[model samples]
Target: MIDLAPHDETDTTALKERERFAQILVLFGRHGLKGLAARLGLGAGGGEPLEDTRPEAIVALLRDIGPVAVKFGQILAMRSDLLEPAWVDALSKLQDRVPPLPFAAVQPLIEEAIGGPIETSFSHFETEALAAGSIAQAHAATLLDGRDVIVKIRRPGIERIVDADLRLLRRLARVAERRIPEIARLKPDELLRHFAESLAREMDLSAEARASDAIGEYLKTYGVRTARFDWELSGRRVNIQERLRGFPASDLDAARRSDLDLATLASTYAQAILRMIIINGHFHADPHPGNVFFLEDGTLGLIDFGAVGTLLPRRREELVRLGLAIASEDTGGVVDILMLWAGDPDVERVRLEEAMAELIDRFSNVLLDQIDLADIFQMVFAILRDFHLALPPDLALVLRTLLTAEGFVRRIDPAFDIARELAPIAKELMRERASPARLRGEAGKLLAALGRAVLSTPNLVGQIEKVARTGSITVSIAPKDLERLRGRERAGRGTPQLYPATLAICAAIVFSSQPLLAGLLAFGAVALAVFEGVRRR
Candidate 1:
C-alpha cells in the first residue's frame, strides 16, 4: 500500500485541492464535456452531454489545477506542433488572464522575502501587480534610495503545489515508459527530469538573478548593453530589479512613433542571439514576444532569465560544425556532426543521411536573402520528426528560442530575414576551421588522443587474447553497464549471453542421446557451434 497522504502542514491544502480537482474531473466526464475533460478524467461520471459554451467553466478548472498546470498550458499553446490551432488560441488567453493573487496577500510575501517592512525596503510600491503570470507576479516599486525597480514575488503555495504535481507526473512518466515503447524513443523519463530542473529553476528567484547578472556581464564584455535587473535586493522568493519602461517589441505603432528602424533593430537582436549561442555558449531559452521589449533608443531588453540553455564545450564545437555544414550545403557533414552529438553511433546512419539530404535540398537553391528563418526551421524540425531524432534538452531550447526570435523579428519587419543576417556570421565561423591557431589546437588534440590509444592498444590486445584463451572476461559493470554492453555487442559482433545458453542446451541434448546417435548428434552440435561462432565473430 502506498501512502498518498500529505507529508507536511503546508502540503495538506494542496492535497485537498488535488482531491477536489479529481472530483471535478469526474463530474465533467459525467456530463460529457470536451475531449480533454475525458482525458483528464473529468468525464468519469456517466451523464448526458453538457453544453460547452461555458468558457468560465474551462477557466475555473484550470485555476483549480493550480499555477504549474496553468503555466504548462501557456507553454503548450506556443507549441503549435503539439496542439490544434484553436486550442493554442484559447490557451494564449491564459498568458494575461491568470487570476492575480490578492493585493493584501502579496505585500506580506514581499516584506517576508526582503525582511522587515515593505516601506523600509522600497520608497514607494504598488499594491497591485503590474503583470500576473502563472508562477509569479511583478509589481512596480521604488527603492528607499529612490531607484525605480520591479519586485517579482512567487505566488504563495506554488512551490508546494508544483512539487506535488511533478511527483505525480514523474510517476506517470515511469508508467508510460513501461507501457509505451515509442515513449522510450522520445526519452520521457529524461524529459521529465528536464522539466523538473526547469521548474525548480523557475521557483528560485536567486538563480534567475545570478543568470541575469552573468548574461549582463557577458553582454558588456562584447560591448552590448542590455536591460538587467539589480539583484542586491533580490532573494530566493523575491527579485528586485531596475524597472525598464519600454514598449513591447511587437508594438509596431510604438516603433513607428519612436522612429526606430525595425530592420536594424531586428538585425541587432538576431546578432545578439547568435553571440549568446556561439560566443558564450549560454543563451536565453525562452525569447517569446512577451519576454522581450524594445526601448526608444532601439536597445533590445530581454527578461525572465529563469530558463536558460547551456552547451558543453564538445557539443558547442559540434554545433559550430553543424552550422558550417548547413551553410556549405554539406549533407553528409551535417549527418556526421549530428551522429557525433547524438552519442549513439549505431543509430540508422542511412536514415539520418537521407533526412539531412532532403533538408539541405529544400533550401539548397535559395539565396541567403530569400531564405526565411521560419521555413528553414520548419524543414529542420520536419527532418527531426521523420528521423525520430531526439535532441538534447538544452539544444532543443536553443532551437526554440531562435525560432521564436525569428518569428518576432519577422513580425516587426516583414523584409528582415534572419538567415541573411546570420550568413556572414556563419561564414566567419567556418573560416575558423582554417585558422592557424585553431588548426594547431586540433592537431594537438588529435595527437594526444592517438598517443593514448597507441599506449593502450597492447594492453587491450593482451586482454582480448587472455579472454579468448580462458573463455571468460572480467569486466567491471557500472550503473550503465547494460547499455554499454549492448553497444559493444552490436559494434563488436559479439554473441549475447543468451546464445551461449542455447548452445549449452544443445550440448545437453547430445549427451542424453544413445551412444551411436550421440556421435552423430555431437557432430551436428559441433557444426552448429562453429556456425554460430563464425556468425558472431
Candidate 2:
C-alpha cells in the first residue's frame, strides 16, 4: 500500500479541510456509508470499515456528496475501462435535480452579473423558475428587443461551494490512490484533473456560450438546426439564449399528436449526429432525451452545451481507419489502429489480435442491416478493457455520445440500423484517407519523423555504447511486481530456516550414537541461519 502523506496545515486550509471532512462524514452517515468512511480511515466515530465496495454504496456516496460529485460520477460512468459494468450502470443514473433556489435568492446575483436589476436588464422577467439544476436555474424572460429568451442564473455562492468541494475531492482522490491498490491503474489524480477542468469550463457561462456558437455554426452549415446564444446578455453566471419551446424527444406521444413523421425525424436526427461526429469532429457530449427537442417546423434543437467533445484530426483519422479495418475483418489492421489510437505499447499483441479476430468473425457473418452499431462498439470497448487499454478522454466521450445517439435514434424507429448508416461514412473516410492531399500530408509527416530519427541515431547509439561500456542499467518494477517479489523472498526465507532446523532435529534423534553426524547437522543448521541473515542484510 502507498502512503497518503498529509498536507501542511494552515488556519484557512485546516478550517476548510475540517468543514469538507465533516460534510463528507455527515453524508456518509445519512447514506449508511459509515463503512466506506471507515475504510478511508475516516472512521465514523465508532464504526467498522466496509470490506466490500458495492455499486449501490458508490451511487449513494456520490449522490450525497453534492452536484459536482454527482457529475463526477456520471462522467466516470462512461469509463467502462476503469469500473465494472454494474458500477457504471448505477453511476450513469446521476442527475442534476436539485431544488431551485428561490428567485429572491438568485435575483441579486443575476442583476449584478448582468450589470442591472431585472427591471432594466430585460423587458419582462419572470420570478418563477422554468427549470432548475444543481448549478443554475433557468427563468423565462423577454429581451429589450422583444425576443423571447431564457435567463439562467447561477445559484448564490455556488462558485465557492463547488471550489471547496473540488479541493476536498482532490485530496480524497489522493487518499483513494494510496489506500486502494486497484485504483492506481486508473490514475485517479489525472482523472480528477480532467474532471476539475471540465467542471471549471461548465461553471463559466461564457465558455458554454462559445461552445454553443461554434457547434451551432457547424451544424447550421449542414442544415442542422440549433439554438444561438446571445453573447450580449451572457456573462460568467448568467446565460441568455433564444427560448426553445417544443416537444422533447422523449415525448413520443406528443410527437404523434403533432402528426410528426417519426421515421423522417429519426433518420434526420441520426444523420445529423453522424455528421457532427464523423464530418465535423465536434459534438454535444450529452444528447439524452432531456436535452433534445423537436421544433414545430421540424427542426431538431439541442441544448445544454456545458458538456462537449472534440476529436483531433489524427484521432478522427484513426477512428475512420478503425471502422474500415473492422469492415474488412483484418485483425492486424485493427490491432494497429488500437495501438496508434490508444498509445498503449504494453498491450499483448497475440491476445489483442485473437480478440479482434473473434470480434470480426462474430460480426462479419451478419449482414450490415442486421448489425447493431452500439453493440459492436461495446464489444470493441470490451476488448480494449480486457487488454487494459484505455481510450483518450475525448475519444471515450465521443464513443459514449455515439452510443447514446444510436440508442435514442433506435427508440424512434426499431428498424433503424446505425451500422448501415455508418458504412458509407466509413467508406468516404477511407476514400479521403487515400486522397492525394491527405497522402501528401501523411508522407510529409512520415518524412519529418524519419529525418528526426536519422539525425538522432548517432546520439542514441552513443548512449547505448556508453551504457554497455559502463555495465550500468536499472530496471523499474511496478508496485504489484515489487510486492510479489517481497512475498517470494519472505516465503523463501522461512523454508530455508525451517528445513535446516528440521533436519538438525531429525539428525539429533536418529544419530544419537553417531556424534559426528549429529554435530554436522547442528553445524549445518547454524550455517544456514547465518547465511540467510547475511542474504537479508
Candidate 3:
C-alpha cells in the first residue's frame, strides 16, 4: 500500500499501475530533481530544477529507474545538439551492464524457443551467462556441428514490463512537457517516441537478426564483419549468432597493441557509415565505439542492431542540398529546407533567413578540414530551438549517428579526418548522380508524379462540382480573385487535355512502378496543381 502525488492521481485506478506509479514517484524523490518532480506534480518537495544542476544525480536516477530510462539516457547522450554538454557527458557514462539471471531461469524459455532441449541444437552450452542487459542475456555455447556461437535470450516477461513502463513514460513525458517549458523545449515527448520505437525493435530478436544480416553483408566491402545469426534456431525472443573474435572498439590500447593499420581502419569505418546514410539510406543508428569491435583478422566487427535509421531518397537529396547550401552560404536554399522542419507554421521566415546568414558567416571561408562539424551542427540546432523549429526525427538520428561515428573513428587515430575522407565519397556520389542511369531514374520519377497529380485531380474536381451544385462546403476568396478564377475556367476548358494525354503517354513508362508513391508529389508539384485549381475557381 503506497501513495504517490502524481498529477493524474484519479486515473491510476488499476491496482498494478498505482503501485508502479508510486514506485516511480518514490524513485524520483529519492534521486534529486525535486524541482522537476514537483513541477510535474509527482512529488511534494521542491528544489533546483532539471536545468539547474545534477547531471550525476540524473544519471543515477535513470539507472535506478531501470532499463527504459537508461535507454532514454543513451539517446540523450547522443543528442548534444539538444542537451547541455554536462548532461551529455554524464549520460554517456551510463552503461547497460546488469547482473545476469541464473541459467535455470532462462533454460525453459530457450528450450521452448529451440523446439526441444538445448542439447538438440547446442553441443555444449555454458551454464554461466556471458553478458546480461535489461532486455536480454547472452551465453557462450558450441552448436551441434561444433561451431562457437553466442545464444541471446530475451528475459522472460520483460516485454510486458517494458510496455507498461513505456506507457508510463509517455504519460510522464507529456505531463512534464506541458508543465515545464525547459522540458517542452527539449522535446521530451518526441525523444521518448524515438526511444520507445528503438526499444520495441530491440526486444524483437527477429528484427535484430534481419538488421544484422543486412548491415553485416553491406559492410563486408569495407573490411567490416558482423555475426551471422543461426536462423533455424532464432525466434522473436531468442537468437544465436556466430561469435566474433575481437576487442571492443573502445579498447584503443588493445588496438594499438596490435599491428593493424589504425588509420586505414578508421577511414573505412567512417566511409562505410557515410555510404550507408548517404547512398543506401539505412544505417546503424548508434556506431558508438562500444558497439564496434576491431577483429583479429583485420576487420571491424559491428554489433547491437536493435536500432537503425533510414533516410528516403528525397531526404538524402535534401541533406546534400543542405550541405552545399551551407558551404556556399545559400540563404534561400537553407531557409527552404529549414521551413520544412519548422515545428510551427508561424515561424518568421525573414528572421530565420537572417539567422541562417549569421550561422553561415561563422564558417564563411573556413576550409571544411578546419571546421568542427559537431560545433557547427550544435549551433544550428540551438538556432532552430530559438526559432521553434525541431529537427525531423530521422534527421536527428542521422546527426547523432554522424557524431558518434566520427568520435568512434577519431578515437582510434586522432589525426584521422572524416571530412577529408568524405571529399572523395562526395565526388564519387556526384559522378553517380550525373550518370545516365540516375538521369533516367529522375526523369521516370517526375512523369510518375505527374500521373499521380493528374490521377488525384478528379477527386478535387468532384469536390468542386459538389460545391457548385450543393454548397456543402464553405468557400472563401477575394471577389476579384473569384472573378478571375471563373474567367480562366471558361477560357481554358478546350485546352486541358493536351498535357494530360502527354502525361499519360510518358507515365505509362514510369507510373507502373511507382505504386508506393503514397504521398502527393513533392511540394512543387502540389503547388502547381493548387495553382491550377485556383486559376479555375
Candidate 4:
C-alpha cells in the first residue's frame, strides 16, 4: 500500500532537513537512482551504490516518496518527448492508492467545509470511506434532500506537506539543472512549474467540481454521462457529487451480464473522447479503466476531473492535420505540423523529414483497422526526443491522454484499433478545414497577420539596420551560469580565510602527537606568514 501518513509542521521544519536528505539518499541508493544521489551531492562517503538501471527501480523510488513525487513521476511519464521510453513505460504504472484514514480524522473537515455538523447536512453519511486516494477520501453519503452523493474530503494537513515537498522539489530541480547537464534539456524547473500548477488546481476540490460540471455538461451534448456535483455544497476541501453505480469498464463479465455491447461501448467512448479533444479542446487527462464506468443504461460515466487537459483551437487543428498526414504517409506534412507545434527550435529539417519518412514507411503498410495509434505516436515522440524537440505541456498531456485511453480500450477488446476510431474525427476535421466558412476565416486570419507584419516592418528594419551598423550585440548572462561564477568567486575569496583555520588545525594535530615536530612547524608557519605579510606590504 502507498504511504498516506500525514506530515506535520515538525516534519517540514529546518531541523528535519538532514533527516529528509538522508531519507532521499537512502531511497535513491536503494532504487538504483544512486547516480541522482551522487549528482545531488549525497553519494560520497557511502557504501557500494546500487547502479541498477531498471525502470521499475525508478517507479519504486517515486512511489516511495509519497503523493507529490508520484505525481511528478506521472507528469514525467507523460512526457515521452522528453524522456526515455523505458522510464516512461515504468512510470506509467505508478498508482495513487493509499490506505484510508480513520473516519474521525476527516470528519471535522467535512462538517467545517459545508458549514455544519454532518448529521444536520446529510440524511445519512457513512463513516467508512468508499475510496481513498493519496490526496483525498470519498465517503458514501445521502444529502439532506435525500439524494445519494459522494462526499470527498481532503486529507487533513496534506496541503502543508505537499507545499513542503514542492519546495524541496524546486530546490532539487535547481540542483539537477546545475549538476546534471544531460538532463538540462528536460527543463526540470519548467516541468516542476507545470506540476505545481496542476497540483494546486487538484488541491482545490471546488476547481475540480467546476471542471467536472463543465465536462459533464459538455458530455451531455455527446450523449455521454458523468456524475453531477452539488456546487453549492462543494468547497475548496469538500465535494459532494452524485454517487455512480456502475461496473468498471474492465469488468467484462459484469458488462456481459448487464447485456452491454462491449463494442458499441468502446466505440462510444472513443468517439466521445475524440470529439472532446478535437471539437471541444478539453478532455479528461486520465481515462484509465478505474476512472471509466460502464453504466447499466449503456453509456459510460467518466469520473475524476482532477487532471484535465485543454488544447487551444489552433493546436487541435494542428493535431488533426498531424493525424491525416500520418495516415496518408505525408512525411513533409508531418514534419510541418511538428515544426509548427514545437515553435522555434534548432531543427535539421532534412533529418526530421527523413525520420518521419521512416516512421511512415514502418506503419504505412499496416491496415488502418490494424494500426496501433499509441505505438505510432510513441515512436514519433521518441524520434522527436532524438531530435531534441519538446512538446509543450498541453500537447504532452493530450498525447498522454490518448495513449491512456487507447490502453483502456485495447485491454478489453484487443481488436479495437485507435487509428480506425480516430479516422472519422480526422475526416470531419478535414471536411471542416475545406469548408467555405473555414476558408474565409483562414484567409482573413492570414491578411490580418500580414497587416500586423507590415505594421511592424519599420521597427524590425530599424533594429536590423542598427545591428548591422553596430557590428556587435550584447547578450545577457544566464542566471545559472552567473550563479556558478559567483560560487567560484566566493570559493576564491574564502581561500585566505581557510589559511589561519588550517594552520591552527595542523598545529593542534602535530602538538598532540609529536611535540618536537609541532614546535618546528609552528616556527616555520610564523616565519612564512611574516615574510608573506611583508612582501604584500
Candidate 5:
C-alpha cells in the first residue's frame, strides 16, 4: 500500500497543496456534489445547493476529477457486494479515456530509457497510440528483426498529479467519515489506500509485464495466451512487448461473423477464467470487453494484467461448499457458510436460515442454466446489508470479476450457462481433494506436526507434572492411548522385553521364536509411537 505522508511527515501547509485541495473541492462543486464537498470540509456544511446525485452524476464526477478519481470509481464498480445495481452498473461502464499525449512529449524519456534512440530499437514506429487509458498509452512498433511489438509508456508527470490527488483524497476521507456519518460504511480511508496501491502497481509498466507471464492457460480449445515482454527494454515507466492478435471479446458482430464456434469459446472462456479464480486463486480482475479479445487463431485471449483478484484456498473451499449447498438445497449448510463469512456466530440463525431457504425455494424450480446470477447477487447483497454484514473485499472482487466476465461471454452466446461450468469445476475440485498427491501432502503435514509435538513433549510434561504436584490431581491415559502405556516394549536386537506390533510377522514371531523379527518389531514400534503422537497432538 502507498503510504501517504501524515501531518507531521510532510508540509501539509504548502501553498501548492492548498491550491490543489481547493481545486478538488471546486471540481466536486462543479460536478454537482457541492453538499458532499461541504461535508468533506470544503465549505459551510449547511445551506448549500447540490445538483443531481444520481449514479450517472457520480460517474461523471469521478471522470471529471481526472485519472486517480476515475480509477477509484472503477475499483468501486467492482464492489457489487457493497453497492446497489444501479451504481455498480453506472460505474462499471465508466471509462478512463484520456486524449493521447503526443509522441514528441514522451520521445526523450523513451530514448533515454532504451539508452539510445527510437531508431536503434524499432525499424518502424507508429506515433499514434494503439490505446489510451488514464495511466498510460500503448504505441505500435516493429523491431529491426521485423517483429511486431507494442510499447507502453507511462504518462509523463502523472506521478506528481497522482501524488497530489492521493494526499488530498486522504485528508478528505479522514474528515468525511467524521462529518458524514453514512460515509463510514464505505470505509473511505481504507478504500483510498487500497486504490493507491492498485494504481501504483498499474502505473509501473514493468510490473504489468511480469504479471502477464504468470497468468494461467485454459483448456486447449478454450483460450489464448498473453503478450510476450522484452525485459531488456522494459522498466518501471516503459514496457515493450510483442503485440497479440485478436478481435475485442465484446464485439458481438466479430464473434458472429467469424468461423469460431461461439458455443465452445463461450464455455471455454467462462471456465478458464473460473479455473484461474476457483482453482488457482489468481485471476484477471478487470476482464471488461476492452481487456479481453477473441483471437484470430480461434482462441480467447486476455490482456491487461494491471488489476487482479486472489482468493485464499480456505475461502475457495468455502465457496465450493456454498455452491454445493445451494445446488443441493441444503438451507442449513448455506446459512452456516454465510454466517461463517459474516464472522458473527451469535447472529439469528433461524432468520438467516429462513432467508436462505426462501432464496433456494425461489430458484429451486428454475434450471441451473436459466438462473440469473445478476439477480441472485443483488438479492444476496441486500440480505447481507440487512444483517449489517459486509462481504470480504476479496470475495467482493471475485463476484464483480465473475459478473463482468459473464456479461461479455453471454454477449457472444446468449444461451451459454455459467452455472454449467460449476459442476465440472466442482468435480475437478473433488478429484483434486482425493488425489494421492494431496493425500500425501496432508500426511506429511500431519507427520511434521506430530514430530514437533513429540519433540516438545518433555517440557510440556515437566510443566504439567509440576502443576499436578501442586494439587492432589489424578493422571490417567485413555483406552485409545493404552498402546503408549506399554513403556517397556523394547525392540533392540538382544532386548528382553517383547516387541508388540499388529503385523502378522511380528505377532507370529514374538509369540513363536524368531531372530530376524527385529526389523518388523522396530517398524511396528515407531508406527505406533507416531500414530499415538499424532493423536495426542
Candidate 6:
C-alpha cells in the first residue's frame, strides 16, 4: 500500500519552495489561473479575477515551468470536460521540448541498465541527443550489426522529483476530499492516484517499450499501419526503437506539398482511434500531432506509446452500448449507462436526462457534413461534467485522446468530417451487438443466472418470511456496499431540499408576473418536480 503521509517539514528551502508554489499558482491563474487556483484552494469569496487574459497567461505560464508543467497543461488541454474549446486549443501547444540531458548524464544510465558500456553494445552511438522530453531523452545509435535505432534513456533522479510532486498532490487530494464537499463526488484523490500510476509507468523506459510492443502487436493483428519497438534492446532506463524519418502530423503544408490526401488521412486516423477503443480495447492515450507522423506514402506512424488506456472486455461492451445509445439518440439509454457508471446510482435522473437531451439534440441532429469532431466531443464532455458523471479513469484518458486526435485532424483539413466517418464505425459496432453468437451467449448467461435464482427462491423466501415473522434479520454488507448505500441516502436527502426551494421561488416569480422570471421559474419547477419524483422512486 502506498503511504500518503505529508512531506517532512525539514527543508532549508521551505521559504523558497513556498514562494515558488505561490508564484506558480498566480501564474496558473493568469492562464484562467483564477479558476485553477480556486480548484487548488488559493482563491477567495468565489469572485472572478480583476484581470483575465486566461489564454495568453496560461500559455506563458506553461512555457515558463518546463516539461512537467507543460505536460500538465497538455493533460488539461484534452479535458473538454473541465475547460472550454479556446483554452483547449491554447494548451495544446504545450509541446514536449525540454533541453536534452548531457551525454555524460545519459551514458551511465544506459550502461547500467543494459549491463554494458555503450561501446560494447553499439557500433556507433551519438553523444548528442536527438530529442528530449520530461522523463527521457533519445539518441541515434547504430547496433553492433549496423541496424539504425533510437536509444531512449530515462533521466536519473527524475523519478524522485515526480514522486515528490505526486506525494504533494495526493496530500492535497485528501484535503480536497475532506474540505471541498461539493467535489467529493468527483473523487479527485482517486483521479490523482490514477494519474500517478500512469506517470510512474511512463518513468520506466522498459515499461514503455513493452507497451509499445503490445500496441504494435494489436495494430498488426488488426492490419493497421503502426510502428514497433525492439524490446530486446530495452531495459529499466533505456528503450531502443526503430527510428522512422517523416514529417510530424501537424505539418499540413509539408503533407500538402508531398501530395497526401488530407481527408483520407483524417478518416484513417478517426477509424484507427475507434477501432482501438471498440475492437482492440487498448489505445495510445496521447495522440497529439507531435507524436504522430506521416510518411511520403501516407502511412501514419504512431510513436511515444508511454501513455495508454485499456478497457476490460466487459467495459468495452458497455462502452459500445453507450456509444450506440448516443448514436441512436436514446436519452433514456444514455441516462441508464451514466447512472450505471457513476459512483452514486441514485443521482438525480432528471438532471442526467436533461443533460442527455441537450447532448443528443446538439450532436445527433447536426448534419454529418457539418459536424466537427472536436465540437461534438466537447459537447459530450460537457454533459458528463454538468451531471457530475465521472468516467472510469482509463476510459476518460481514451476519450481525451480521441478529442485531441479530432483536433489534430481538424487542423489538417477544415472540411474533414470525422463524425461522418465515425458514424459508420458506430453503426458497425451496433451491428456486432446483434450477432447471433453474441446474442446467444448473452441469453445463455442470463438464463443460467435466472435458473440458479429460481432454484434457490423457495429457501430465500423461507428465510425472508422467518425474518419478517421474527422481526430480526442479518444481511452481509461489504465496505463498498456501505459506501454505496451512504451515497444513495445522501443523494435522496439532498433531492427534497432543492425541490421545495425551487417551488417556492417559482411561486414567488409567478406572483411577480415578470415574463422572463416566470418562464425561468416554470422551467426550474418542472426540473425540481421531475428530480423529486425520480428520487422518491
Highest TM-score: give the candidate number: 2
What is the Cα-based lDDT of residue 37 in candidate 2?
A: 70
Can you rank all candidates by lDDT, best first? 3, 4, 2, 5, 6, 1
Model 1 C-alpha lDDT per residue in residues 407-431, reported as the tens digit of each score? 8877877887656777777677768
State model 2's lDDT: 0.75
- Name the lDDT value of residue 388 in candidate 2: 70
lDDT of 3 by residue, 15-89 (tens): 567688778778877876667677777766553566675889889888998888888888888775577677888
Clashing pairs in 4: none
Candidate 4 clashes: the total is 0
After superposition, the stretches of candidate 1 with alpha carbons farther than 4 Å from their true spots are 1-64, 73-97, 181-184, 221-225, 340-348, 431-437, 459-537
* RMSD (Å) per prediction: 11.2, 15.5, 9.8, 20.8, 11.0, 12.1
- Score candidate 5 by lDDT: 0.73
Better of 1 and 2 by TM-score: 2
Which segments of candidate 6 are over 4 A away from where they belong? Answer: 1-70, 83-95, 181-186, 221-224, 345-347, 362-365, 417-420, 459-537
TM-score, prediction 2: 0.80
lDDT over C-alpha atoms for residue 273 of model 1: 78
Better of 2 and 4 by lDDT: 4
- The local lDDT score (0 to 100) that residue 7 gets in candidate 2 is 52
Clashing pairs in 5: none
Output the TM-score of candidate 3. 0.78
Q: Write the per-residue lDDT of candidate 5 for residues 1-537, one digit (tens) a residue.
A: 112234443565466676666676687777777766665557655624322357887788778778888888888887765667788889988778889999999888789889999999999999998898878898999999989998999989998889888877777778767666556666778788778877888888888887787774432334557778889999999999878788887787877888989898778778878888988788788888877777888877778888977899888878877877798887766766776665654554556666777988998998889977788888888877666556667787889888877887777778987668888887899998789998897699777866776686786456434443453333565753343223213211111112223442343334334435744654455556565444222
C-alpha lDDT of all candidate models, in order: 0.65, 0.75, 0.77, 0.76, 0.73, 0.69
Task: Please give, for residues 470-490, the per-residue lDDT of candidate 2 as tens digits.
Answer: 545434678754654454454
Q: With candidate 3 superimposed using the best TM-score fit, by how many Å does residue 94's alpha carbon deviate from the native? A: 2.5
List TM-scores for all candidates, in order.
Answer: 0.73, 0.80, 0.78, 0.78, 0.77, 0.73
Q: Candidate 3 regions off by >4 Å?
A: 1-13, 44-50, 440-537
